[model samples]
Target: MKLITLLPILLCLFTVAAKAQDNNGSNPQEKKVLKLINALPEIIASNKLRMKKDPQRLLKAYIEFTPTAKDKYYQVSVCDDFADRLFAYYRFKVNAATYAIFYDDFENGKLVPLKVWQKHAYGIYSKR
Candidate 1:
């Protein structure tokens, strides 16, 4: 009788655990952020500087959450770390929901859309 009662309890516990595991992958926004983060390195590499005169192995990259009241996104940054000093090569924001990208145009004090930024990137990268 005790074994019979314990069997149902064990089965219930197992079902709850299985459902918890299933719920972990159900968040769509998390999946998008993970996918974009994985691909950012390759995207940055495509536009990297290739001057023979410049030093090699000086660039490092990071992806961070950009805190906001309503809008949410990830910030991808590639920086030059030389002699313990850091200089940002570029910073971009990718929307958490739509995956739209915006470049941080600090000089102009605005966020530039990826399409427009690409036009500027073409000239910067074409010479190399």
Candidate 2:
């Protein structure tokens, strides 16, 4: 008798939980984009720490992002306005589905995994 009485309540709770997990049924791509956008501040903060020199010696460093063709990734570009010039710091390709990040290796002519990219970039940028 008690099991029967509690079953409807359990079903209602489960339905609510499922709905909450889906962001109220919004588009999946939109959710991914929003998640990345929301994380931008933390991302920029971390990259700032990787700088060998103070990128903000004259002005603040900032990061920008745009969806790549076909929307599979976001092209993340870093730059700073200093000394009356736009100084580009680095570029990254962020996966839309997995949120994985890759460094745009202009020197090597290929995208490199972030850990490898970081090792190389941080070597060039950070003092160790």
Clashing pairs in 1: none
Summarize candidate 1's per-residue lDDT along 5-117 as a digit string, tens digits: 99999999877843321111246664454455435543455436433345553444445454366757666565655675566677777786577877766566667777776
lDDT of all predictions: 0.57, 0.55
> lDDT by residue for model 2 over 1-128, one digit each (tens)?
99999999998977784332221115665455445533554455654664646645322223344456765766555555557566655666778667787767667667777776556535253332
After the best TM-score superposition of candidate 2, give how far the Cα of residue 30 lies from its true spot, in angstroms: 9.7
Candidate 2 matches the true fold with a TM-score of 0.44
TM-score for candidate 1, please give it: 0.48
Q: TM-score of each candidate? A: 0.48, 0.44
